[model samples]
Target: MSDLRTELSTNLDEAAWEWLIPHVQRDAVIVVASDLDLLDVGVAIASDNISSVQQWIDQQLMVKPSNTQVGNWNSDRTKKFHTLILQPYVLVQEMAA
Candidate 1:
């Protein structure tokens, strides 16, 4: 887990860093799930401000394609290569808690 955290922090591009730092500081869990040809970095913001989350996602897409992949993987090696698409949505239940 620590290694994965380090890799994410180190490999994230400038745009990612800029968008992620504040969320991270606010205790959001940022998960980077990937598939064969797409990387979906979801930010679980614990807030009701859905617009803010969407804006952040839009900013990231402006810098690069939202469906961009981080690396190449052989399809044969895995059954399904579907990753969690980075959709910034407010987890209302979690937020209420």
Candidate 2:
């Protein structure tokens, strides 16, 4: 396995760090894909500071409801309510190297 390191500097709280760290570490590719009009906004928000990203994520998660049910309703309903958003950052180093 390849080990990747990403450092995020933001004003986000410790809780946000707990949530985001694992996702960033597991992601193989980070893609910034959004509409042109939203590009500037996205980049600006993403680059502003770590706190900004954390706040955005927290807000998104707040509005979204989690689906823990398992059954026929699990797949379809779960997909409709899920959201994963993040800013793309360059891979700075590989610890396994």
Best by lDDT: 2
Candidate 1 per-residue lDDT, tens place, 1-97, comes to 4454444344333232333334434544233222211222322232234775466556553122122221211212231222222333111100111
Q: Which stretches of candidate 2 lie over 4 Å from their true place?
A: 1-37, 61-97
- Steric collisions counted per model: 0, 5
TM-score of each: 0.22, 0.22
**Candidate 1 displacement at residue 96 in angstroms:** 34
CA-RMSD of model 1: 15.2
Q: After superposition, how far is residue 2 of candidate 1 from its true place, in Å?
A: 22
The reply for model 1, stretches above 4 Å from the true place, is 1-44, 61-97
Per-residue lDDT of 8-78 in model 2, one digit per residue for the tens?
A: 22221122222333444565212222222223323445456567546545554212222332232334432
What's the distance in Å from true for residue 51, model 2? 3.8
